[model samples]
Target: MRDPLTEKPRRKIPSRLIEVDAWIDSSLWRFGHGFSRFWESVTIFSRRFRARGLNKLAVEVACEGLTLGVAGLIVMLALAQPAMKLTANGLPQQTDYSVLFLDRHGNEIGRRGVMRADAIPIDEMPDHFIKAVLATEDRRFFEHWGIDFFGLARALSENARAGGVVQGGSTLTQQLAKNLFLSNERNIERKIKEAFIALWLESHYSKREILSMYLDRAYMGGGSFGAAAAAEFYFDKDIRDVSLAEGAMLAGLFKAPAKYAPHINLPAARARANEVLTNMVQGGFMTEGQVVAARRQPATAVDRSTTTSPDYFLDWAFGEVQKIAGDMPHRNFVARTSIDMGLQQLADESVEYHLRQFGKTYDVGEAAMVVLDDDGGVRAMVGGRDYGESQFNRATKALRQPGSSFKGYVYAAAMEAGFKPDDKISDAPITIGRWSPQNYGRSYAGTVTLQTAIAKSINTVPVRLSQKIGMDKVAALAKAMGVESNLRGDKTMALGTSEVTVLDQATGYACFAAGGMTSNRHGILQLFDTNGNLLWDSKRDMPPRRRVLSETASAEMNQMLSQIPIIGTARKAQLSMTRAAGKTGTTQGYRDGWFVGFTGNFTAAVWFGNDSFRPTNKVSGGGLPTMTWQRFMEAAHQGIELKPIPYIDNTMPERKAPKVAEEGDAPPPVRPASLTTAAQKVLAQIGMLMSSAPPLEKPEKLAAAAGDDNAVGRR
Candidate 1:
């Protein structure tokens, strides 16, 4: 303000304001420079054209045309960069996800993901197939460059006459370009780009190469993509083997794949195929007689059995796969499972039939079965009566009391503690805490051998033994034998109050079958990726089995259990062809019944109950469960040779089976009938007192006095 003459005191400008001012000046100068360059280009072209001695009107019109051409070129250049970025390298590589499962013998058991055929090459395609595609898709494919001008005129006239888009003028190259680079949006700009890219594709590739790309990348019906996949999916045949009618049908799928799918709508598919054949006839590629013969040939479809309902094995294997390869992102993989499909089918049928025939009589609504090898490989599993109705997988998920089946562990512990099969144990009532446990029939057998007690399933013997050996010790033995359920360390636990899954019970029983070695139960044997690369092998990854029970204890326990079918409750489970040993368990209220048994070849467990946990109508493990087990086992062991179990004849060396009690070996001294009345009265009084008293304070002492050895009563 003080120096007006000296360019006025430029009010000391802020540094930021001065920079912004300079930027604005530079931007304006650049914009002017670009405008001048554009103007100069237009002027130079106009001058060049005018210099060729053109008339005034022609020059004006030529300049206008040149201006529009330049504008369009600029617009195309603007779009080309993004289009190039999107397409990258022509078409994207297809990533298809397909999973196939096979049994141990490599027979296809089931499959997951969309069905696809093998890849087919264009050179191997027949001339009839190529002609069909060309006649249906593009009539002027050989004559047109990229955009079919005559075809466009014809299509426009046809559409105008029909009042709808009855025909499309797009060449095969244009369709390929749209599929490769752009979305399926119909607009003026997209059409322009499609035309341009079609020209580009035509210039870069031969007619055969273009057709090959088109056929290879086209999407067909039924989750199949390409000619090869379509051929196999529809006809169950290779691409080279597809007949003339089939090829025409496949080509017709290009219009509306799902709408004209043969499996979905045969009439629509056949009509479309007829239209293709007519086009072929018009194009001079097929005679009317050939068309008639082709029309007469009905479509041959793939078998539907390959897509049958998957069993429990597949459900279990897929869950494990998810755990191994979290989220299962691969498009294709192979799961090799241990299931025997034939046995699995039999098991499923058995379960359904049993439920239908005897469900109401037994008051049972559901059942589950699991068959495992001694090595812990699950061979077959039926989780429910109907897989379509529910996929709960009860064999591996549902937990119910094992009941008497768990008594094996109690006896196993007793044998470990130096108890023999010939040892005497009391079957009389005993009081532990406020609970007075009684026998199953409320009857007692006095002075019975341990083998007799087990054969008869006396409730008092196992409880007495569990009390003698700590309750915790019995539970520990059960865990070591592969029972994974939580068990209570109470005297009542000897009665199998703990609940366990059928899989765990089967695995636990398998440990006994395997001679005291415990193995990890699993369904999948191996897994592979799409390229046949091994992903996981159960044999390599599974932990080695540990010897949990001694050979003596295992053999003694198996021998005692084998008596169940021979003389005890499970008499119906006896097989005519082979011998089996197992235990039957029925819960207190008859709510849950189980029969877990094993032959040398297979160990199986069956459970019957209502999912609501309501009590069944007096259903016992020895009845319906044993019946189902026998049915499955009879079928499973039909053609297999019999082999002895690990403890078929193995017995304890320390204890020998006692001889039958003779007349002179009787207890409570017997006197001649001529004895005095005073002695008889005294004996009668003592008998009354003994009946009222608890079991002998030291039955071992009485056993000693009676000339018996190793006799111990329940503590």
Candidate 2:
């Protein structure tokens, strides 16, 4: 309406509004001028300040501080790299299963795993026991954070005065952090990570929680973990039921479990316990009168010397259980292993007796043995002289040269290539690629049968046979027979220059006992949960045995090997009541001596050597190893019917395949069903013929097996 097209509008605004707009514009212009003048003055003053050198010094200091902060951050990240890579799946909770091991007869032999399931709550622990640990390990644990500077200074002073490390400065929380997340490596990086993780644990858990974790996670001696397990292991009582003296001894083990383990060193453990009592008195945790009784009556551990643990066998069987049922959610297991405690005891005693009797004379320090049934179930394993002195399982872990014992595979390969056990071969000196394999006595037997050549352990026969049949075939045949160790396809492999474990020898020899079937070596027989649910049964889950060697080849090998105990290098390995078959192996320089043989009931491999690989004093496979084998086998065969080896004289009944369980009987169904009546009748007739059949007699002479003269040429 005011615009009204192009008509001029009348003035409707008040004069006061025009005056106010003019005033605001003048004020803004004056303010802009003042700010410009002030900025210029400040810039001039800053330039003057820079010229005085203090500003330069301040800037350099700030830059140095920034650089140091960045470097420290980089170092800290590097130190924490190990911790950062760890997954927070279970945190401080142990992921390993607590395994209670029982022998073949269902008798509890030992226990393995960390025993985290047996952890006792902090509130259930005795007050005096807590005071004992705190006084000996960390007196000011409750008063400090994760780290205590005053305690560290005092420890340093005490160490300086003693000229050695008399005390540890780490608080209980720090120890818990280390046990939970770090290895026992003594280095600066590990220490830094431990300190940082200690801070993290302190922030995440209370003092009681930290102490409880420490008590649960620390490793005590004799394969026990946590205070609860240690209490049961040492005193044969629960942690809450232990007296003050026993608690003091338990607390002393935290410093050095191996050194002060009551089961191992009672005197040293008592001395350490006395020290704990003194510490309790000096820390004001207990008065002299309160600790006097504990000091007087030192804790005594239960007698474990007479108790045979079979720790090495348990170690191996525990590993097998882990492999079979590792993915299961339940972590507490009761494993029924294939170990026979009677045979295990005999094996241990045999090894110890031999080592004590002839060890010094032969200058041999270590020996290992493995015994397996025809079904490939491990019966007994002697890893070393004593489990306490060393825990390395030589039976399952150590790999040494097999020597002449390996000739069985080479001969088996030859038999597979259509050569008979009585086939003639030249036993004269021969060489292959600058390698002249001589007999153990360095004497040649001229022309001889394969049976005689193996019986005497002539080196040149196998070399010639390997050259004719090819080394690859020999290696493959050995692998097929269940030699799990690596076999080199070389000329020397015919003489067992390749290395293998005692278990491998047993497995390979078991093939002969199994009538050429694969020996699926296994230690665990059945695994069960705490509630008695069967988690794994070896016969159900294990791979079925397949034919590795033809029946003819296996029969030939067994016939030839059976001659060894009767007239070969393994004469001492002959059992009193049962027939045995096996080959003897002696490495170069007498570094390793092995007698691996098998009865129809059991196959065993015995190795005698030094752990350092030092040469023994002329200890041949026929000597100490055979004697040990003889002693153990004689004891193992008592009170049981002796079965005849396959292909040898058959006086005993023939072995039949295990009867398969019928349907609706068990959850783990075996083969389809039992044999039919007609099939059983046919098998019975065959068994009668086998038992009544006469043994194959060795021929007086046989023609030489045709071969290329230049097949194994000397370089």
Maximum-TM-score candidate: 2
lDDT of 1 by residue, 188-307 (tens): 777878887887788888888888878876666554557876786788887898889899998888877767777767788889999999999998888998878888885656654344
Q: List the residue pairs that clash in candidate 1.
A: 97-331, 98-331
Q: For candidate 2, which ten residues in a row score worst on lDDT?
A: 698-707
C-alpha TM-scores of all predictions: 0.52, 0.65
lDDT of 2 by residue, 1-715 (tens): 4565545333435556788999999999889999999999999888865734787788889889999999999998787666665524536545466677777655567777664434688899999999999998888888887998899999999999999999889888888777777655457777887787777777777888889988887877776768988898899998999999999999998988878989889999999999999999899999999988888888899987755577788879878888888679867677778887777877887788778877888999999999998779998999887554455788988889999999989998999999997889898888777878788767887899999999999989999999999999999999999888988798989999999999999999999999899989898887866544567888899999999889999899888888787777887776657788898889999999999999989999999998878899988998888877877887777766577887778443232222222111422111123344366468746744664344222100000000111122100
Clashing pairs in 2: none
Q: Model 2 compared with the native: what TM-score? A: 0.65
Per-residue lDDT of 397 in model 2: 89
